[model samples]
Target chain A: MTRARALLIVPLAVFVGIVVLLYSGFGLGRADLHPSALIDKPFPDFELPTLAGEPPRRSRDDLVGEVRLVNVWATWCPTCAAEHDELARITGETGIGIVGVNYKDDPNAARAWLAERGDPYLFHIIDARGDLGVDLGVYGAPETFIVDAAGVIRFKQVGAVTADTWRDSMAPVVASLQAAAP
Target chain B: MTGRTVLGITALCIAATLASAASLVDAYDFDNPALEARYRTLIAELRCPKCLNVNIAGSDAPIASDLRRAVRRMLEEGRSDQEILAHLQDRYGDFILYNPPLSPATVLLWATPAILVLVGLLVLRRLGSRRDAVELTEDERARLDALGAEDP
Candidate 1:
């Protein structure tokens, strides 16, 4: 190629690269949809009190042997409340188990919120101090994780799981995981 | 006002300011200076997972405070710096650290500056070679000599 043509190629390649990069970055629908590092890894070990404040506290051992959605939520987060009904509907329709993590919330307030809003989870782990939330890399409430039968995390959905979210993003993953389960 | 009274008021203000500043720093008591220094350094290096761009030491978020406490606790437990960082990384991934570890995913991020420099040097060399490749025609050389001679 001529020197001018060679020089032109460099800038053209750079422009094309930058355009592709920018377009891909913008194509990502949500800014909060960060990729979780714990995907495909076993759930973090924790033996925390149940939200019911009963005996037989739950731990990582309880997560195995089932395909479930481990949802991180709190009474203080309004988005969690907003998604509560949708979550219950999802469980009702899909027959998929949901385990709740009551992160960094007052136990009384959390219990009241669940009772008022209607509890969707099979059981709730009280992460009152957020220690278990930290262990699970939960930065905010309304985050959901799909854990396979082996207790391996398959996918993480940040923010509230509305009906649309379940239909589009989460339901497919859950279906696939359930199909794959023994 | 009398000079003594004025000095006493100024001293009081200074003392008050110092006390307030001290209160701003987290009061985690360390058994030794080395442990305290390590705690400070670790918090400074660790990014606040909840915030946009602030390190744990600089952020006031609840998560940042919790991370700060965790770092101090680990340091007291006799964990090495790498161990502490790895502990956070295992949960939060490499995003928790301001300086990410070199891996297949981050190779491009770490290599971009050097790649830019290499490209710049190559361009510079090409330009230099092009300048050298240019040979003035005999007539042009004579004209250039004549212009130089006229300057004298």
Candidate 2:
């Protein structure tokens, strides 16, 4: 082949390869790599402190023996701010203990954010370094996980913990866990 | 020209070609400081389709440039970072973000790698057993030894 034709074919071949790779799932996009459906599996183990001014961490032990909604949030995350009101309302209405995992956030900022908005968390666990969040496979906040009385993870919501989500999706899962005898 | 001069001229032509082929660098211009900072942050969080791990802000790929332009346009229109990101997600699907939206479509993608690994393991096991079973026949082994001896 002539040099010009060879050069043209080279790029064309590369473009075709990329298209094939995309079709075959190599470039399937990061959104395709989300494991949000393993809702009913056991909750991953975690340990973190509550905000400094607030009470000490309530531990994974405290999480057992009751259906709880664990929310991973950070003061820095914009979505967390958006969902704060919904969380407060859910706590007030459902009476299902809403636990908070303040993933990789400043303790002072977290306390202030909660103070400014209203702390809906029954007890906030400070995942200051994001170690606990990693265990939960939390890519970002505000993510909510529902753990049963037996500590089995029954549900997970990847984004903002809104009232609609709590009522429509989370509440039913929590209720089922409540009705079942340990 | 003599052979050496011809070779030197060819080298100069190659150098000139390389210089002309080099891509131009773009300088960042921020009209609004707050908007620019937010734009930078948003772009940094977005994954480039062509360069996968390198974010739009960091990548020089054409697709990244297009995404950066889109981000700037959205910011200039007074859209918040969330709104801009949502718009991008809508246009490109959740793949635009480094952290993808956890939806039904994504659940399958997340599970597929593990499933592929499992399937591969199963295939390997079957192939391994077949390989073990299809050991060289005595005649084939003798022929292989004869071929090796001839090569030596």
Please state every model's RMSD to the true fold in angstroms: 6.2, 17.8
* Candidate 1 chain A lDDT trough over 10 residues, lowest sum: A28-37
- Note the B-chain TM-score for every model: 0.73, 0.51
DockQ result, candidate 2: 0.03
lDDT of 2 by residue, B1-152 (tens): 79999999999999996665443223458877988788768978998754557777677765566667667777888888889777666434466688776677678868889998998899799879978897798999999999999984
Clashes (N, CA, C under 3 Å) per candidate: 0, 0
lDDT of 1 at A21: 94
Q: What is candidate 1's lDDT per residue for B40-143, written digit by digit as tens?
A: 89988999888869898877688887788778878888999999998888778788899998999799999999999998999899889989999999999999
| Per-model TM against the reference | 0.76, 0.48
**Top-DockQ structure, candidate number:** 1
- Steric clash pairs (candidate 2): none
Leading candidate by lDDT: 1
Ten contiguous residues minimizing lDDT sum, candidate 2 chain B: B19-28
